[model samples]
Target: MTSFAELVRYLAERFLQAGIESAALDARLLAAYAAGFSPEETVTKRDAALPPEVLDRAVEAARRRFAGEPVSRIVGAREFWGMPFGLSADTLDPRPDTEVLVEATLAWCRKHDLAGAPLRILDLGTGTGCILAGLLSELPNASGVGVDRSEGALRTARQNFARIGLDSRAFFLCGDWGDALADATFDIITCNPPYIETGDIAGLCPEVRDFDPLLALDGGKDGLKAYRDIVPQASRLLRVSGLLIFETGHRQARLVRDMLTELDAGFQTEIFPDLAGIERAVAGVRQSGGDGGRGKKKVGNPIGSG
Candidate 1:
């Protein structure tokens, strides 16, 4: 029988040889999962021999990882905003970088004293509902509706909302952007739309290019297609003083900011960076009735950039 520690080391070596970046961490996670051990238990029982079945499962998981499967996919769940969210083939994997959108939204909510308000949120392209889940979890008085085009993605989002105990506070819709919603219905609209340029999809890391749904990856020729679609819809869906926030691709922040500004939507735009200092999220607050919803400006804030 292979001991848990031995299996972890073996898997780590193979993953390292395969050039997997998080080799050691992935190996341990796979081994722990196979053994049905919690992370803490995995540490405490590292020396214990894994049962034959457990060892077999761990090896199989290792093979899948070697084939470029993400550890989160292998485990069927991922942690985002300190919460575990389920995933599906149709849903884009919830990533830490995308958390920038959530952080910035939260910061804005705090600064505006809306955290405790019964805020209504609409999350576009809400794969796995991670963004909506994160916001709803943090803002206790907030409720949300998540919209996605994929039925499978919507199913996963529904499951995720239930898993996180926010089902009662959340709803899912199958539609194109805000096509299925009423005008000025939400106080906040968030999106992490498909932003990878169509031509650039082939160049993405295999973990993404291979596994994530194509509908959630292809952002058309300029990689700003989704933004173009969502922004116009957001202008109508968001209430006065409402906020529209989005996670942008590499160096795409300025373009996204420009889109919000150029539109006659009375938006006040801001750019925020992620931990790696890449401008990852852009937020725009819709101004009230003045200027007939045409006032626009660009600004910057440091609330959750890091």
Candidate 2:
């Protein structure tokens, strides 16, 4: 191609023919990634001819994309909470909907005037460590430990935190849920666990079904396995009045809330919608104990009616 625009359009047409819905945007992003340039730079230089090496890179990326590999997988990164996170074969790519968990936690902290205090945070099923890293970026005084069952996921998570200069404030551990946490309690605990049921896994989109790790997607028979595995531990892992924020699968908010409530009577739950008006997240506050009654505060939903 003689120009970046031409390259992008060519790639877009290929992707379109391949039945990719976000063809144009994906093409542009892939071209920029392959060319070792920012998407903005690619846009600005759209009319310029690509270097032979860059064209080769773009061609290879297109081939992979055509083969059903996600652009994030081909590019080895995905942006979450406006920051780049490295990806691993075993880690779930960060999804925009998961950001609801971060937003909710931040709002909870702000409402309780806990944002400025030295706080410990925990992230179960950390995946790309997106939730923990995103929270640390906003809560300056917060230090977090991200626990994942996959060592590969942990490695990529560490890379992401270090890439964004949050490594000093972030710790990664390999374990299933809160098993590694012991008696340690935190000001906020977050998770975006695998909530897609095993039977439903086959129906996921190509990117999720083929590119995302099964370990990060399969939630058991009813998609409630992770909830069952996490709720009881989370109840113990949170300090009295601490917050537990997590993302759930479609239509999972209410059931997940019930699971938490049944697991611990101390927690008071609130469900919030994502930007798309879907109830995608639930946050529970540990009530009772020394200064642990924030659940009784009238802090309304932080992410109000979407």
- The number of clashing residue pairs in each candidate reads 0, 0
Per-candidate TM vs. native?
0.94, 0.92
- lDDT per residue, candidate 1, 105-142, as tens digits? 98888887888999999999898999999999999999
Write model 2 residue lDDT over 30-69, tens digit each, in one string. 9888777776788678788888898899999999988889
State the RMSD for candidate 1. 2.2
Among the numbered candidates, top TM-score falls to: 1
Q: For model 2, where is the 10-residue window of minimal lDDT?
A: 289-298
Model 1 stretches astray by more than 4 angstroms: 289-306
Q: After superposition, how far is residue 203 of candidate 1 from its true place, in Å?
A: 1.0
